[model samples]
Target chain A: MRILPRTAESGSYAALAGLAPKRRPSLTPYYFILPYLVFFVLFRLGPSLAGLGIAFTNWQAVGTPRFVGFANFEAMARDPRLGDAFQNTVFFVLLTVPTLIVLSLALALFLNQPRRGRAVGRVVVFMPYVIMSTVVGVLWTWILDKDFGLLNVYLNFFGIANVPWLVSESTAMYGIILTTVWWTVGYDMVLFLAGLQDIPHELYEAARIDGARAWGVFRFVTLPLLAPTTFLVLMLTIINSFQVFDQVYVMTSGGPGTATLTLVQYIYTTSFQFQKFGYGSAVALILFGILVIVAFFQIRGYRRGLKGVE
Target chain B: MSRTISRAAWYVLLAVVVALVLAPALWMLSTSIKPEREIITTQIRWIPQNFTVEHFQAIVQNYPMMQWLFNSLFTATAATLLVLVLDSMAGYAFARMEFRGRGLLFMIVLSMLFVPIQITVVPLFILFSRLGLTDTYWALILPVGANVTGVFLMRQFFLSIPGELEEAARVDGASAFRVFWSVVLPLARPALTAVAIITFLSTWNSFFWPLIVTRSDSVRTLPVGIAQFLSLRAGMVQGQMSIGQSMAGAVFAALPPIIIFVILQRYFIEGISRTGIKG
Candidate 1:
């Protein structure tokens, strides 16, 4: 874990310069990594660092950002819109993550078994993941279209009344969640399937021979083995749910009156639509901070679970 | 026996799950082929009564679907190739090279992965505007020339490459680059292919950046074009007929990713599965 290379290695690199020894490996790495490094710095690093500065300024997208140290953050502390975005974002994370986790796990477990037509089922389940969020938004808009939506149509077929799916604030978030779950669960399922594959069959057989019930085997063998995949999926689901912008932008446009305006969509609208770059950076910074916290916990949880380390 | 009933229940439950998953996709296809009137009709039909290829034909007739296809192909392929070559070299250097600040530089490089594409959008737009590179290929390609995921993957791959082979090459008087090309590159095919497929798909499926960067249809790629066409309908089914025509367009949009995924499935899954290392 030494940060720098040994002096002996450094001298060797110098001596082996002309000979171009692969072991000494030249300054070639710097030359090689330059393209990606340059772009990464220019695009990802530059904007992020600039945005960090903007969080403390009064940038308005068109002019010089006057330094207003912590004013944006202070404004964000009392901003009603940010509060709503945060509330809605938290609700979305809470709502979508659990549903996606349970449903995807159930689907994955179902497909994990050697059943008939499992391959067809898996591929079919995975199809929605391939479509664009815009398309998913559009398709679901029609399907949940209050007047002509297939759901309302089906409900009527069963003697139910017409329900405004996306028009109502209460139902709108549900519509987004439903669309997201159906469209996304397959990806988590695929990850789970890979995890399920890694679980040795003989372990199940051994448990079966020892007179363990199906539930017992799943609890003891399957769950423990699949925890890593589940953890990864949970991590993804939480990140995705928090950063839920596309569906909001596409489906409801963050309405029926700001019911589904997620943190990301809010940040997006703040900068682009409202052109409040400084406040937007504050929002972005808050999101960044929240993600960092979530990531820290997730990493800690993963390591503690995997290595039993504190 | 209860076994028969249980089996039937499992099948039925799975049937429902499959239906839920495929319904939107099938709906997309169904709408794409449906004739104009049928789409607007109050009638709710799972399968279209009258299907036509009009939408596909319309795209072919009025729009530069072919040009869009070519742009997507050219950009994705070129970007994938560039990422592969550049990423692999950098990966090898970082993993194997004994140099100053190598580890620190790599940590910095990889840290860029945490910065979501959205954070970069506004500044990049400004930067590209200043460079007057907007609407051009550089606007599209240059910014993504070196992806962090590709570098991370390639570096991991290089670490796994046997140090003895590298030492053997040096012992045999082979140049560093020579050993990399001859010994390292060939052996890193599986990793390279994984990197290639993932890179290709990401580039192909890239949306916000391409939409922001490209000014007109001549440069606009499939995702943006499809978004434009879809959004023109403005989240409505105005131009759509019988769901079949729109379905056809949806199918067309999703086809390349499917074909590529199927062709390079092993690499595709591996690449995706590994790309979540931070997660």
Candidate 2:
């Protein structure tokens, strides 16, 4: 991959040397970075630190904040809604990630083949991804409506009973999951297609000379070569799924007795609706902590995969 | 003969996949055109028999749907422009310049990626409210404009452009900014376009922050406005939800991004693949 050169020390010097004129020092670079850094600090870094601080204080919007010292964290621990939100988030992650990986990979492999009309197929598959999340949520909610829903209509045609997808607790999360997969699989598919394109055809030629069957070629050659892309897709999908909110908010509003209440939705309700900014910040930190830990493990696994590839 | 059969089968499978993926969008369009009575029918109609533009007219005339669309366009465009300038400058510095603490600062910026941007929302809301920026377009435009991923992407792209072009321009007595403007920026068109498309799509589609910050219809972006519309209609008397109007609103909200995707499909796909490689 092109990224292989990035780990070398000389790459940075090469890049820096490119920017220099007559081997003299220049301050223009700092000027370039300053504008972005200002906003970055004010909006990103400063707010992140403030969020951490606010998590410990009882700061409602109007009142002077008093230091509460882990009370919010304790509240998070005891709150059943938070627990439900946590479990639902985990359930959503588990439900979506593996399925997304497998399905997108399959689609990518299918489309990777040389065929007529593949361009149309690619565009068709990718179109849903560009639509806004709220639109996806609203459209899917209507399509899953028990009475007039297209899904129920199809089911009825097949002699099946009407299933209230978003209204029922058992089915609501799954509906959200299905909608998500439909919406996002195109991105991962495109990534996998790129990975497939990156693999040298010489290896496939060698396998063919050795009389390898199609399945054998895919299993032995394709899968091993695509490991890095798979890792990238897995990490991104996991991180994104853990923060699922918009669709859940629009579709179910974390409703039917909190069945689809994701951590993000929980945080929003706590901070915005209930005006418990401090407790909301605490939950947000918890979410941040969990994401960091998850990302850490994923990075560690990626390194291990790289070493194995080497 | 066997190869031909398999190719035919692939076409069939691909067709089924396309139909499944496009069904919801196609249904939304269909519903947007259908008359009110037809939309509530249990029968599945892929094509509306009684087509009418009343729903589209209704939303535009009565609701702030047009305002939401305009707000979405204005904010998304501003955010995209701001991101391109800021991220490209920062990316150039990281890619090409050596300043004091450059490496450390670069690492800090990269680490910001994992910070889970939602963590900033509570504090940002409070800060913006304090500044009296809440419920305004500035509140929607600024935070999103500060995204660091564009910086990373632009840096990656700048790295790929060989140093000789910039060096040549520099030796010709062009200032750093001048060289960047005339030489590097033109060459960086593909990357800039990618960043622009991504920023516009995200800003236009952004719901969570706008939903939190903006309380009035005057400043609400399309996604939030449409969501509020759905909730409001759903909450009213049973069966009062304006299906056609809501679908029309959704179609309006969806069209710009979808059209952009259709036009710039290559860049979209290329950009995603590039991010995977770079990440």
lDDT of 2 by residue, B19-67 (tens): 9999989999999999988988898888888889998888788778879
Candidate 2: where are CA atoms >4 Å away?
A: A1-25, B232-240
User: Can you tell me which runs of candidate 1 are displaced by over 4 Å?
Assistant: A1-25, A307-310, B1-13, B59-67, B232-248, B262-267, B276-279
Docking class of 2: medium
Q: Score candidate 2 by lDDT.
A: 0.85
Give the Å error, residue B91, model 2. 0.3
Tens-digit lDDT track of model 1 for A1-310: 1111223465454354544333443455567667767777787788788878777888887888899988888888788878988999999889899998898888889987788978778777765776666667767777787776777878898888877878888888888898898878878877887788788999999999999999999998888877788887887788777778766776777888888888888887888778887888778888878877888899888887877411
| TM-scores for every candidate against the unseen true structure | 0.88, 0.94
Alpha-carbon shift of residue A20 in model 1 (angstroms): 9.9
